[model samples]
Target: MADLELLDKSIRRVPDFPKPGILFYDITSVFVNPEAFKYCIDKMVEIYKDSEIEAIAGVDSRGFLFAAPLAEKLGIPMVLIRKKGKLPGDTYSCKYALEYGTAEVEVHKADVEKGKKYLVVDDLIATGGTLVAARNLIEQGGGKVTDFFGVIGLPELNYEKVLAPSKITTLINYSGK
Candidate 1:
């Protein structure tokens, strides 16, 4: 079993980060602590170890942090879902709304094997726009997404609604319980 207390304590909450009134759950703190980072990967590994997921599609930058190790452990290929134009060769892209504006994500067409089941991963799930966009790109490229995983989630924001019909899992949730 994973130690929820240690993982929760490993995260640092920054107030008004990138803008005012925003309480950012900084996951970089996990990087500085080996135990917590290992715990995270171990937990996620446990979650999907017996599953039928063929690949992991990680969202740009942060998502790669968690996905790479998970894919390695599962012995599956890791696909990168990057921002528009970041990937080379023929690509599939999708646009999603952000807090301030819209952003686009893309995946290399070659990375996606048609009809293979994929799992989308990220550091956290706040509003779900990015993950939803990632799912679209994967499907548009002929890959099917079986689930979404985040290290943390903010249910207070009601993100599940935006990501409706898709299952998502998170290790920690800040819902003011």
Candidate 2:
């Protein structure tokens, strides 16, 4: 099994962030620790090195951090899935519901080529709304989503079920926060 206690400890938890009664798991703390950051990338590489992934599609901002390095290490291309209006070309967008409200995400239509295999990367997976949106965007562009990768997974929300039939890999999991 992949042990991530050190990386887990590196994450900072803030209660009621951006709103009341909501706990946020901030990953910026892990970025400050070189060992922890490298460990995360290393573990992700170890898991997917044999999967013949042709490209990595990182889910907006935070996912970019993890996907860029991993794409370089694996010698694959990186695609960006960003918030609506962030991309500057023809794009495909998907709207999904969030815990608080509804949100939309998009990706450049040309970035994902037909039949290409892509792995979606993000810092964490909570309700999985974003991941689902990202996947739909990729599929709309004719790309296949091989799996979903995350540094942390909040299982209390049952994201695993929400993303059923799609594989998910996370370094550490926290239950019943």
Candidate 3:
């Protein structure tokens, strides 16, 4: 694994972003640093290399950054879990709650094949709503969510409880912003 201390420093903390009194841990800084970006994916691969994952289900946008390369490295299929109406064909949708309101996510009905195992990837985990919803969409489409992986985790929110019974792995954790 890469030096987590140095990787943690690469992440930028921005306060009051998109709202008042909310400290946002911006991952864009990590994306710019090749070493940090590779470290994040390397650690994730190291952790799951032997898990026999058949596909990687990446939550929209930021999740694609890490998941795409990781899926390439692992030689597995990459499944996209997108927002409502973003997918073209038949899709399975799940509604999840955000801090302020609820949002919906969708996955193509054909992408999640039966008997395949998937790992859900995201940039970060706060309330765990998105990951939970992603897992639901995957299962509802006939694939199993083997695990949930994130580059960063905010344990202060106690997302572990919300994602109970399924394992969640993260490269770094911050108690608060």
Over 47-157, each residue of candidate 2 has an lDDT whose tens digit, in order, gives 988896889999989999999999999999999999998989999999999877999999999898999988999999998999999999999999988799999999888
Summarize candidate 3's per-residue lDDT along 100-171 as a digit string, tens digits. 899999999988989898899999999999999999998898888878999999998999998877788999
Ten consecutive residues with minimal summed lDDT in candidate 1? 168-177
Model 2 local distance difference test score: 0.91
Please write out the lDDT profile of model 1 over residues 152-176, one tens digit for every residue. 9998888888777767899999864
TM-scores for every candidate against the unseen true structure: 0.95, 0.95, 0.96
User: Model 1 off-target regions past 4 Å?
Assistant: none
The segments of candidate 2 whose C-alpha lies over 4 angstroms from its true place after superposition are: 1-3
lDDT of 2 at 1: 21
Task: Count the clashes in each prediction.
Answer: 0, 0, 0
Clash pairs (backbone) in predicted model 1:
none
Report how far off residue 153 is in candidate 1 (Å): 0.4
Give candidate 3 misplaced runs (Cα > 4 Å): none
Q: Over all chains combined, what TM-score does candidate 2 have? A: 0.95
